[model samples]
Target: MRMCDRAGCDQPGNCPAPKSPNSPERWYFCERHAAEYNSNWNYFEGLDKEEASAREQAERAEGASYRQSSWNAWAGPGDGSRSRDELRALEVLELDPDADFDAVRKAWRSKAKLVHPDVRPGDEAAAKEFQKLQVAYEVLRAAEERRTWKGPEGTF
Candidate 1:
Protein backbone atom coordinates (compact mmCIF):
# COMPACT_ATOMS: atom_id res chain seq x y z
CA MET A 1 0.00 0.00 0.00
CA ARG A 2 1.97 2.97 -1.29
CA MET A 3 0.95 6.31 0.26
CA CYS A 4 0.04 9.29 -1.92
CA ASP A 5 3.09 11.56 -2.32
CA ARG A 6 1.04 14.77 -2.36
CA ALA A 7 1.35 16.80 0.84
CA GLY A 8 -1.54 16.46 3.34
CA CYS A 9 -2.95 13.46 1.46
CA ASP A 10 -2.53 10.37 3.64
CA GLN A 11 -5.00 8.19 1.74
CA PRO A 12 -3.65 5.11 -0.05
CA GLY A 13 -3.99 4.87 -3.81
CA ASN A 14 -5.01 8.54 -4.04
CA CYS A 15 -1.81 9.69 -5.77
CA PRO A 16 -1.08 8.91 -9.39
CA ALA A 17 1.93 9.96 -11.43
CA PRO A 18 1.37 13.06 -13.53
CA LYS A 19 3.06 13.56 -16.91
CA SER A 20 5.75 16.26 -17.13
CA PRO A 21 6.42 18.14 -20.33
CA ASN A 22 10.00 19.24 -19.50
CA SER A 23 11.51 15.85 -18.80
CA PRO A 24 10.98 12.17 -17.95
CA GLU A 25 10.54 12.94 -14.25
CA ARG A 26 6.99 12.46 -13.00
CA TRP A 27 5.24 14.01 -10.02
CA TYR A 28 2.51 12.29 -8.10
CA PHE A 29 -0.64 14.22 -7.25
CA CYS A 30 -3.76 13.37 -5.35
CA GLU A 31 -7.05 13.62 -7.23
CA ARG A 32 -8.00 16.96 -5.67
CA HIS A 33 -4.58 18.52 -6.33
CA ALA A 34 -4.55 17.20 -9.88
CA ALA A 35 -7.88 18.83 -10.63
CA GLU A 36 -6.73 22.09 -9.09
CA TYR A 37 -3.50 22.07 -11.12
CA ASN A 38 -5.35 21.35 -14.34
CA SER A 39 -7.80 24.18 -13.74
CA ASN A 40 -5.08 26.73 -13.05
CA TRP A 41 -2.83 25.76 -16.02
CA ASN A 42 -2.98 28.16 -18.95
CA TYR A 43 -0.86 27.20 -21.98
CA PHE A 44 -1.37 30.48 -23.88
CA GLU A 45 -2.21 32.92 -21.16
CA GLY A 46 0.87 35.15 -21.58
CA LEU A 47 0.63 35.58 -25.33
CA ASP A 48 -1.77 38.02 -26.92
CA LYS A 49 -3.60 37.24 -30.17
CA GLU A 50 -1.17 39.25 -32.31
CA GLU A 51 1.90 37.65 -30.77
CA ALA A 52 0.47 34.16 -31.25
CA SER A 53 -0.46 34.90 -34.85
CA ALA A 54 2.99 36.36 -35.58
CA ARG A 55 4.71 33.28 -34.13
CA GLU A 56 2.56 30.97 -36.27
CA GLN A 57 3.36 32.97 -39.40
CA ALA A 58 7.08 33.01 -38.65
CA GLU A 59 7.09 29.20 -38.16
CA ARG A 60 5.31 28.66 -41.46
CA ALA A 61 7.71 30.96 -43.32
CA GLU A 62 10.73 29.21 -41.79
CA GLY A 63 9.39 25.82 -42.92
CA ALA A 64 8.86 27.10 -46.45
CA SER A 65 12.37 28.57 -46.61
CA TYR A 66 13.90 25.29 -45.40
CA ARG A 67 11.99 23.33 -48.04
CA GLN A 68 13.06 25.70 -50.79
CA SER A 69 16.68 25.63 -49.68
CA SER A 70 16.70 21.81 -49.68
CA TRP A 71 15.13 21.64 -53.14
CA ASN A 72 17.71 24.07 -54.52
CA ALA A 73 20.58 22.15 -52.92
CA TRP A 74 19.49 18.78 -54.40
CA ALA A 75 18.34 19.92 -57.86
CA GLY A 76 21.65 21.58 -58.83
CA PRO A 77 20.96 24.76 -60.82
CA GLY A 78 18.65 23.52 -63.63
CA ASP A 79 21.23 22.93 -66.40
CA GLY A 80 18.48 21.56 -68.69
CA SER A 81 19.01 17.96 -67.58
CA ARG A 82 15.44 17.73 -66.27
CA SER A 83 11.95 18.01 -67.72
CA ARG A 84 11.55 21.55 -66.51
CA ASP A 85 13.43 24.23 -68.50
CA GLU A 86 12.97 27.20 -66.22
CA LEU A 87 16.49 28.29 -65.17
CA ARG A 88 19.78 28.32 -67.07
CA ALA A 89 22.84 26.74 -65.45
CA LEU A 90 24.45 30.14 -64.94
CA GLU A 91 21.24 31.60 -63.57
CA VAL A 92 20.90 28.75 -61.14
CA LEU A 93 24.49 29.12 -59.95
CA GLU A 94 24.32 32.89 -59.78
CA LEU A 95 24.15 34.48 -56.36
CA ASP A 96 20.65 34.32 -54.96
CA PRO A 97 19.04 37.76 -54.81
CA ASP A 98 18.92 37.57 -51.02
CA ALA A 99 22.27 35.85 -50.45
CA ASP A 100 25.03 37.57 -48.51
CA PHE A 101 28.55 37.94 -49.97
CA ASP A 102 29.97 34.89 -48.20
CA ALA A 103 27.16 32.64 -49.41
CA VAL A 104 27.63 33.89 -52.95
CA ARG A 105 31.33 33.11 -52.89
CA LYS A 106 30.75 29.63 -51.48
CA ALA A 107 28.16 28.80 -54.14
CA TRP A 108 30.42 30.08 -56.91
CA ARG A 109 33.33 27.95 -55.71
CA SER A 110 31.21 24.81 -55.52
CA LYS A 111 29.69 25.18 -59.00
CA ALA A 112 32.97 26.28 -60.64
CA LYS A 113 34.76 23.22 -59.30
CA LEU A 114 32.24 20.91 -60.94
CA VAL A 115 32.65 22.47 -64.41
CA HIS A 116 36.41 23.05 -64.33
CA PRO A 117 38.01 21.44 -67.41
CA ASP A 118 41.12 20.27 -65.51
CA VAL A 119 38.73 17.91 -63.76
CA ARG A 120 37.57 16.31 -67.08
CA PRO A 121 40.97 16.23 -68.91
CA GLY A 122 41.72 15.66 -72.61
CA ASP A 123 38.85 17.62 -74.11
CA GLU A 124 39.22 21.06 -75.74
CA ALA A 125 35.47 21.67 -75.59
CA ALA A 126 35.48 20.84 -71.91
CA ALA A 127 38.26 23.38 -71.41
CA LYS A 128 36.21 26.03 -73.18
CA GLU A 129 33.26 25.22 -70.94
CA PHE A 130 35.53 25.49 -67.96
CA GLN A 131 36.61 28.97 -69.12
CA LYS A 132 32.99 29.96 -69.23
CA LEU A 133 32.49 28.60 -65.72
CA GLN A 134 35.47 30.64 -64.53
CA VAL A 135 34.03 33.78 -66.07
CA ALA A 136 30.66 33.20 -64.48
CA TYR A 137 32.19 32.60 -61.08
CA GLU A 138 34.25 35.76 -61.33
CA VAL A 139 31.28 37.83 -62.43
CA LEU A 140 29.10 36.59 -59.59
CA ARG A 141 31.85 36.99 -57.05
CA ALA A 142 32.46 40.58 -58.06
CA ALA A 143 28.76 41.32 -58.12
CA GLU A 144 28.34 39.89 -54.63
CA GLU A 145 31.14 42.03 -53.23
CA ARG A 146 29.71 45.13 -54.87
CA ARG A 147 26.27 44.34 -53.54
CA THR A 148 27.61 43.91 -50.05
CA TRP A 149 29.62 47.13 -50.10
CA LYS A 150 26.88 49.07 -51.81
CA GLY A 151 23.23 48.02 -51.58
CA PRO A 152 20.70 45.67 -53.14
CA GLU A 153 20.62 45.79 -56.99
CA GLY A 154 24.14 47.23 -57.06
CA THR A 155 26.20 46.30 -60.12
CA PHE A 156 29.82 45.13 -60.15
Candidate 2:
Protein backbone atom coordinates (compact mmCIF):
# COMPACT_ATOMS: atom_id res chain seq x y z
CA MET A 1 0.00 0.00 0.00
CA ARG A 2 1.40 3.41 -0.95
CA MET A 3 1.52 6.07 1.73
CA CYS A 4 0.03 9.50 1.23
CA ASP A 5 2.53 12.09 -0.10
CA ARG A 6 1.20 14.78 2.16
CA ALA A 7 3.33 15.13 5.28
CA GLY A 8 2.09 13.59 8.53
CA CYS A 9 -0.83 11.82 6.88
CA ASP A 10 -0.97 8.05 7.34
CA GLN A 11 -3.86 7.54 4.90
CA PRO A 12 -3.52 5.41 1.82
CA GLY A 13 -2.44 7.27 -1.31
CA ASN A 14 -5.33 6.80 -3.71
CA CYS A 15 -5.89 10.14 -5.41
CA PRO A 16 -3.48 11.76 -7.85
CA ALA A 17 -2.95 15.43 -8.72
CA PRO A 18 -0.36 16.79 -11.12
CA LYS A 19 2.61 18.28 -9.32
CA SER A 20 2.58 21.06 -11.85
CA PRO A 21 0.75 21.97 -15.01
CA ASN A 22 1.95 19.96 -18.04
CA SER A 23 4.19 17.87 -15.81
CA PRO A 24 4.15 14.07 -15.69
CA GLU A 25 4.99 14.05 -12.01
CA ARG A 26 2.08 13.70 -9.62
CA TRP A 27 1.33 13.86 -5.94
CA TYR A 28 -0.47 10.80 -4.59
CA PHE A 29 -2.68 11.88 -1.77
CA CYS A 30 -5.66 10.59 0.15
CA GLU A 31 -8.94 12.00 -1.18
CA ARG A 32 -9.09 14.84 1.35
CA HIS A 33 -5.54 16.04 0.79
CA ALA A 34 -5.99 15.81 -2.95
CA ALA A 35 -8.94 18.16 -2.71
CA GLU A 36 -6.91 20.52 -0.51
CA TYR A 37 -4.00 20.50 -2.95
CA ASN A 38 -6.24 21.12 -5.94
CA SER A 39 -8.02 23.99 -4.20
CA ASN A 40 -4.70 25.69 -3.44
CA TRP A 41 -3.16 25.03 -6.85
CA ASN A 42 -3.15 27.59 -9.63
CA TYR A 43 -3.04 25.64 -12.91
CA PHE A 44 -2.11 28.83 -14.80
CA GLU A 45 0.17 30.26 -12.15
CA GLY A 46 2.95 31.39 -14.54
CA LEU A 47 0.90 31.79 -17.71
CA ASP A 48 -0.09 35.20 -19.04
CA LYS A 49 -3.35 35.81 -20.90
CA GLU A 50 -1.79 35.50 -24.35
CA GLU A 51 -0.07 32.23 -23.56
CA ALA A 52 -3.29 30.85 -22.20
CA SER A 53 -5.14 31.93 -25.30
CA ALA A 54 -2.58 30.33 -27.57
CA ARG A 55 -2.71 27.11 -25.67
CA GLU A 56 -6.47 27.06 -25.89
CA GLN A 57 -6.31 27.66 -29.62
CA ALA A 58 -3.86 24.83 -30.12
CA GLU A 59 -6.07 22.50 -28.16
CA ARG A 60 -9.03 23.50 -30.27
CA ALA A 61 -7.07 23.08 -33.46
CA GLU A 62 -6.09 19.62 -32.36
CA GLY A 63 -9.71 18.85 -31.60
CA ALA A 64 -10.74 20.10 -35.00
CA SER A 65 -8.15 17.87 -36.59
CA TYR A 66 -9.84 14.85 -34.96
CA ARG A 67 -6.73 13.90 -33.04
CA GLN A 68 -7.06 11.58 -30.09
CA SER A 69 -7.85 14.12 -27.39
CA SER A 70 -6.59 12.62 -24.18
CA TRP A 71 -7.47 15.85 -22.35
CA ASN A 72 -11.08 16.13 -23.52
CA ALA A 73 -12.78 19.43 -24.50
CA TRP A 74 -11.49 22.68 -23.09
CA ALA A 75 -13.78 25.09 -21.23
CA GLY A 76 -12.53 28.29 -22.74
CA PRO A 77 -13.12 31.80 -21.44
CA GLY A 78 -15.78 34.22 -22.72
CA ASP A 79 -16.16 34.29 -26.53
CA GLY A 80 -13.08 32.01 -26.76
CA SER A 81 -10.84 35.06 -27.17
CA ARG A 82 -10.08 36.27 -23.62
CA SER A 83 -8.72 34.34 -20.69
CA ARG A 84 -10.50 34.17 -17.33
CA ASP A 85 -8.00 36.57 -15.85
CA GLU A 86 -8.48 38.93 -18.77
CA LEU A 87 -12.24 38.75 -18.33
CA ARG A 88 -11.82 39.58 -14.66
CA ALA A 89 -9.60 42.50 -15.60
CA LEU A 90 -12.24 43.79 -17.99
CA GLU A 91 -14.82 43.53 -15.23
CA VAL A 92 -12.54 45.47 -12.91
CA LEU A 93 -12.29 48.26 -15.45
CA GLU A 94 -16.01 48.06 -16.32
CA LEU A 95 -15.33 47.32 -19.99
CA ASP A 96 -17.07 45.07 -22.48
CA PRO A 97 -15.47 41.80 -23.56
CA ASP A 98 -14.45 43.24 -26.93
CA ALA A 99 -13.15 46.54 -25.55
CA ASP A 100 -9.93 47.75 -27.13
CA PHE A 101 -6.52 48.00 -25.45
CA ASP A 102 -6.70 51.79 -25.55
CA ALA A 103 -9.95 51.57 -23.57
CA VAL A 104 -8.22 49.32 -21.06
CA ARG A 105 -5.43 51.86 -20.59
CA LYS A 106 -7.84 54.75 -20.13
CA ALA A 107 -10.02 52.90 -17.63
CA TRP A 108 -7.00 51.66 -15.70
CA ARG A 109 -5.64 55.17 -15.36
CA SER A 110 -8.99 56.54 -14.25
CA LYS A 111 -9.76 53.84 -11.67
CA ALA A 112 -6.23 53.46 -10.38
CA LYS A 113 -6.05 57.16 -9.60
CA LEU A 114 -9.05 56.84 -7.32
CA VAL A 115 -7.61 54.07 -5.13
CA HIS A 116 -3.93 54.81 -5.49
CA PRO A 117 -1.96 54.31 -2.30
CA ASP A 118 -0.21 57.64 -2.71
CA VAL A 119 -3.53 59.44 -3.07
CA ARG A 120 -5.22 57.58 -0.20
CA PRO A 121 -2.40 57.16 2.29
CA GLY A 122 -2.99 54.97 5.38
CA ASP A 123 -6.06 53.30 3.89
CA GLU A 124 -5.40 49.56 3.72
CA ALA A 125 -8.57 48.80 1.78
CA ALA A 126 -7.84 51.41 -0.85
CA ALA A 127 -4.27 50.20 -1.14
CA LYS A 128 -5.47 46.64 -1.71
CA GLU A 129 -7.97 47.72 -4.37
CA PHE A 130 -5.25 49.77 -6.04
CA GLN A 131 -2.99 46.76 -6.14
CA LYS A 132 -5.78 44.68 -7.67
CA LEU A 133 -6.33 47.33 -10.33
CA GLN A 134 -2.62 47.44 -11.09
CA VAL A 135 -2.41 43.68 -11.60
CA ALA A 136 -5.53 43.71 -13.80
CA TYR A 137 -4.07 46.52 -15.90
CA GLU A 138 -0.80 44.66 -16.27
CA VAL A 139 -2.53 41.48 -17.43
CA LEU A 140 -4.50 43.39 -20.05
CA ARG A 141 -1.44 45.35 -21.21
CA ALA A 142 0.68 42.22 -21.62
CA ALA A 143 -2.10 40.53 -23.59
CA GLU A 144 -2.38 43.57 -25.86
CA GLU A 145 1.36 43.64 -26.44
CA ARG A 146 1.37 39.96 -27.21
CA ARG A 147 -1.45 40.41 -29.69
CA THR A 148 0.49 43.12 -31.55
CA TRP A 149 3.97 41.56 -31.45
CA LYS A 150 5.36 40.73 -34.92
CA GLY A 151 8.58 38.84 -34.51
CA PRO A 152 11.34 39.31 -37.13
CA GLU A 153 8.96 40.04 -40.02
CA GLY A 154 8.82 36.42 -41.26
CA THR A 155 12.42 35.48 -42.10
CA PHE A 156 12.73 33.55 -45.36
On lDDT, the candidate that comes out on top is 2
Give one digit per residue, the lDDT tens place, for model 2 in 32-129.
Answer: 99989988887557899999889889888877633311112132223456778899999988998878788889999999999998899999999999
Q: What is the clash tally of candidate 2? A: 0
Q: How many residue pairs clash per model?
A: 0, 0
lDDT of 2 at 129: 93
Per-prediction CA RMSD (Å): 16.6, 12.1
- For each candidate, the alpha-carbon lDDT, in order, equals 0.57, 0.79
- Compare the candidates by TM-score and give the number of the best one: 2
lDDT of 2 at 63: 78
- TM-score (all chains, Cα) for each model: 0.31, 0.50
Q: Which ranges in model 1 have alpha carbons more than 4 Å from their true place?
A: 1-95, 149-156
Instruction: Kindly provide the TM-score of model 1 when superposed on the true structure, using C-alpha atoms.
Output: 0.31
